[model samples]
Target: MMDVPSIKDFQWKTLAPLPSRRVYCSLVEAGGQVYAIGGCDDNGVPMDCFEVYSPEANQWNSLPPMPTARAGVAVATLGKRIMVIGGVGANQTPLKIVEMYNIDEGKWKKRNSLREASMGISVTAKDYRIYAAGGMGGDLRPHNYMQHYDMLKDIWVSLATMPTPRYAATSFLRGTKIYVLGGRQSKYAVNAFEVFDIETRSWTKFPNIPSKRAFSSFVCAENNIFSLGGLRQGRLYRQPKFMKNVDVFDIEQGGWMKIERSFFLKKRRADFISGYLKGRIVVAGGLGNQPTVLESAEAFHPGKNKWESLPPMPTPRCACSNIVVKNCLLAVGGVNQGLSDAVEALCVSDS
Candidate 1:
């Protein structure tokens, strides 16, 4: 049997930060560049701008704005193209539009729309196909439906639905399989975990997470899936509050384990967007209570299983998306006091 390593030896460092602030944006790596798409600002206004980061230059450049301004969207990359999926707009309305951006051609094109409108959806790309998992939809409510998009054919088809409906969950692609972690439903948070088999066209329940959470970051590294810090229910200042805790799941063994370590940032409820770059997990911004937006960033090393602080972003944000392009991590638009058009780039090598 393959050996499982302990999470003690991991090391991490932060690079630079993005220029703009946003939330619920899309992040993807294409043509050796990282792209950040539409999201809402701190005041809850939706944005239409998008940007890209080139690792070779260690800088960010503006791109054509999204045809529609929205947040809580999903993004995936196939070859040199990036796909932006459904999300919520400033009116708090769900969207089903799907758009494609070609890095090589520097252009945007509309593609097949989703069967159902969804926001805060978990999306991943495997074998050139993009899978859209459980999210909020249908009159701006959460749903258990799952959708699949074929980039080669430019088509979308409905698939097996999730056992429990959720939003703000994170999805990761390992081999031919897709794994989804915890998120919130209408009534409460969920510890439920599920996996979708691309070849079987079906869904199966995995072991429940040790803790229930929503808006947390999820990533796969060294054959293991890690669940980062998120809000847990608690009473705060004579009111309910969200707790911050980190956990992990061993996909090969099918079990969950919590990481007992102190966080550099304060505990707050916010969506986490992450990417695996250079054998490290890069976590960008998130939202807390009054501030609602965060500017700090961190990295986790699977080899050590620990967190390390990095440079703070110029613009604080939550519900944003990030993806690795070449060696840099690109953070896209998100809410920072208001819907923002800000974008940032970070390089671990600089640290």
Candidate 2:
């Protein structure tokens, strides 16, 4: 392991805040602008607040809200169109409503909805098609789903179901395959690691994640998948604890890295914002072992196999909707004390 940097590695910058506070909102980048979709308000009620931030002007302008109000929705950007998939609605129940916002047209249009209503769906856009995987349904059970939106027909076609049913899983589209990692079945975390080949239209079961923890982050860096810190479930003899354990899955080798060769994060975190940045695995604010939310940040330098300290977040919060745009990682609305309107970005510093 390399020594901790004496100088700062990453820097934080405060950006123009959102129009209003939001939690569980879907943040996506399209046409070089970041769009914030539906999310819950202070009372935990879903809102149909649609807004976009123009980096050029550093201003946020409101767009027409969605026809339905919902939160925890899966959003994908295709050219000028943004597809908002299944999510929790006003009644605090899962919904099948599917809507697309055409930026060029500046209007929301209804699309063929999902066959089953669910939330926490993992969605990705490739070519012109959208692939939506596992999600939790109204019954609160995770579904072994695998479906793709048929853009030409304006309909959803079911494909091979995943071997392990889960919700809120992280997915990465590599070449023609979609690698889906851990998600939750209910309150319990699912360790299933599976992949779907677009060409073959089938699912292949890979090795399950070595560590089974809730609220863990599964991120893709170069050719490897890293499962970072989370809340480790305890047995009857012990209490639940936060974790800093890190596990790496080597794609070329088709297996996990040796446990002895794996490393650990600098801090134990859960429900944090993480992303692959400038050849490093970066993690920001989240709930740690303490009662208060954490503001610390760190980055794992793969070449050195070491985690170096970085700048802390301007507004410390958890469960923030995060996305990597250009060279910056934007952490949008989250629960800071209460609902927070803070919009901050972790940037690559020249110094």
Best by lDDT: 2
Off by over 4 Å in 2: 1-9, 259-262
lDDT tens digits, residues 1-351, model 2? 323323265788899999999899999998789999999999999999999998878889999999999999999987889999999999999999999999999999999989999999999889899999999999999999999998879989999999999999999999999999999988888899999999999999999999999988988977889999999887789888999999999999999998543378888899999987777788999999864698999988776677877878989999999999876899999998899999999988544
State the number of backbone clashes in model 1: 28
Supply candidate 1's per-residue lDDT for 159.
87
Assess every candidate by TM-score. 0.78, 0.96
lDDT of 2 at 2: 29
Winning model by TM-score: 2
Whole-model Cα lDDT per candidate? 0.69, 0.90
* Model 1 C-alpha lDDT versus the unseen true structure: 0.69
Please give, for residues 117-192, the per-residue lDDT of candidate 1 as tens digits. 7777888887788888888876646788787887778888888888878886767666677787777776467888
TM match of model 2 to true structure: 0.96
CA lDDT, candidate 2, residue 298: 90
